[model samples]
Target: MKILDRYILTSFLKTFATVFVILFFIFILQGIWLFIAELAGKDLDAWLVVKFLLFYSPNIVPLVLPLSILLASIMTFGNFAENYEFAAMKSSGISLKRAMRSLTVFIFALSIVAFFFANNVIPRAHYKFINLRKNIVQRKPAMAIVQGQFNAIGNFNIKVDKKSGENGEKLEGVTIHKRLPGATNTTVIRSKTGLLRSSENDNLLQLELFDGYYYEEITTKKPAERKKVPFAKSSFSKQVMNIDLTMLNNNDMDKEQIAHTNTMLNLKELVYTIDSLESNYSKERQSITDNITNRINLTLSKPKIINPILDKKIVDTTEVANTLAERDSVPDKLLALFDTNEDKNRLLEIASNSLNSSKFVISSGQNQVREKIKSINSHWHSLYEKFVIGFACILMFFIGAPLGAIIRKGGLGLPIVFAILIFIIFHFINTFGKKLAQENGIPPFLGAWMSSFVLSPLAILLTYRATNDIGLINMDNVLLPLQKLAQKLFKAKSKEAK
Candidate 1:
């Protein structure tokens, strides 16, 4: 390597490594805050906590990569400017652009690393990190429980009877209260023997009862009731109930469960889900259409029937009027079979209500089905955002490197401050755009990449001006003209006064 090449490479590496370490520690500290919250008030071993942070490292690497690059470049070039190395190099016919060539190549390599980590390593590590957290949370009752306290596990309030390492678990005398919603009823269960066991699937606090009687009470708010309800009682032998104690006080699993979202899914899976939901929606729509058609056809194509009993009734009435209209001629059985006017009206009303209910059932089902399909369709957008926006890391470096050289100040001074402000704006816009896009106002791709698109050009413009030494805004030139004009006007006014 040439002396100049080595110089640029060394400068880039030293700055990048220093900034990367600082940012990486910040990431670890944030991860620890999250992990401690997950640990809750429960005691966990140091090794387990360390393992979680280690597993989380790859996911943090990609986000930190771009910022590290920005800071590193600014520092390297700023140092070069401050030391007059840049001026010396330019004097020897080595252009500013040529000196940066080595560092540019290094930045390109870092971009590739960012891409590889984001696409493959980070995703896999994210999955592993989630699974590891799940395992840790599900460890054992001892892991989830503090030594001396009342811990509410699932539907049961539990107190530890004894804890023995030799027995491989904690023994507890268990009391359970099961409350079902809507009714003022509660069942109380007591156990003489209980043990808390940690399994691969979940943390289990199992209860074994030699003999325990269950007591239950049901209450009602209604008054003026005629009868008293009977009380229920039950007794059991050797009852074993498994309780998930981990979820009693922790919300980590809830967040971890969201990894199943489509953002975690690859393109193929998202496509499959969308296709399946759309197909189901289509089928449901067709079914509703067919049902409506069938109902219409049934209503329109009714067959008419002649009534023999009505003809008989008319003949009988005519004969009765000829003989003695006032005489009672109808038999009870025949009269009972005849429909009264009120009865006829009621029958018509019932028929109308039945038809309306059938229509309503079909309409409600169609609406519910449509909503489900929409929900499924909305599920993939978040996954799309997380996976697609990751590509912006590489693009950010392109902009960062050029802008650093243009700014010509670094080392946590103006350049560093400028970079942070720019990144902050970029981050805010990206987040805001994502929220709007998720609600379907804008396209997902546009929202995710908007920041990079807007900032990259600004970087380029700055670089162009800096490279040609074309000043962006010459405050000296701008203010000097205004001052001279003011002086001339003031002198003219004085001459007129004289």
Candidate 2:
């Protein structure tokens, strides 16, 4: 490579490394916080936590790369500009465009890497991250148990005085507060010594305690009428109970209850699901429309029939008087027209029931149609997550490069703060888009990409103006308007006081 190329490449790489380290540390800290909160009490190896973070690094790296590149480009250019090296290069017969060519090439290569990482590597890592956590949660019961706190393991909220052994296979003193779901009272069990073991056949964590007492507390709330008795305790030499975690979670049956969302699905799988859901929704809507039309046509085609039951005679005078709202209103001529009012009432009731049944069927069909449409909508909305996240790299580069050039600071202080602010805004907008898309059926692609799409041109315009020395709005300009407004308000306030 030429001296110029080497110099530019060196600057870009150095800035990239610096920005990456800072971002990666931030991601690592977040990972640690999440794992501690979620996986701390679980019986998993410390190495597994390390592995989880490391495996997830690629996922985070792609997200950070675009911004990092943008920042790196800006810093590299800003440093050259500040030191007058850009002028020196220009004096030495190197163009401004030429100086950036090396960096641009570097960025292009990086963008490709970012795309692959985000599209393929990151999605796979998400699955690994999810599955690793699932395995840890399912296989390791000891890690799930907290020392002092009440840990609801399976159906038991257990606390241990001391835990020993490498795998937490032994407990010194164990107190279990068990409450099966749908049960009225909680069962308290104390064991002098206990052992936790997993079932070989399934993911069931079992507790075998020795020399323990089982006490049940039943609350009777009729204090005025009933006497209160304390809990009854029963001592046992040894007790064994096995609880199946899998049995408790019927949602994880691997059935098609809900769509596995976008981040959870690969590209092919996501596309297939979208297509299938769309087709199903279309079919359901058509079926519902056809059913409603057929039902209406059937109703219209039905011949009117004269009912013998409605024309039945009323034999008892007392029954006739009770059935009629007013004897004078019914008129003496029509009073003996019906033989039996019960028959007429029964026929009217049958007609009402049939009408209600038809209405119910139509309503149910409409509900199903709405649900199917929602399923299709949800599938599309899910796809937006991947779409937005995948393009964040390109967007970050746009903003980062310009901001870095504008700030003219290479180190972590101002540049980092600005980068974080930009990221925060971007993330907030992205999240908002997701919420709107999910809830309101806002155009999925438009909603998800709104931030990046809107911001890109602004970034480009800023970068172009910065590079070409064309003036655009800056922080000083933004503050100027606010400052003027504040001054006017202050003057008005002072004049009024005077």
Tens digits of per-residue lDDT, candidate 1, 65-167, equal 6677777777777778777777788799987678878877766666666554554556566776877776565444446544445554455555555545654
Q: Would you estimate the TM-scores of all the predictions?
A: 0.63, 0.62
State the TM-score for model 1: 0.63
| Least well predicted 10-residue stretch by lDDT in candidate 2 | 250-259
Candidate 1 pairs with clashing backbones = 161-172, 263-383
lDDT at residue 120 of model 1 (Cα atoms): 58
Please name the candidate that would achieve the greatest TM-score relative to the true structure.
Answer: 1
In model 2, which runs have C-alpha deviations exceeding 4 angstroms? 92-95, 142-241, 244-260, 287-391, 472-498
In Å, residue 183's CA in model 2 sits off its true spot by 18
Shift in Å, residue 336, candidate 2: 17
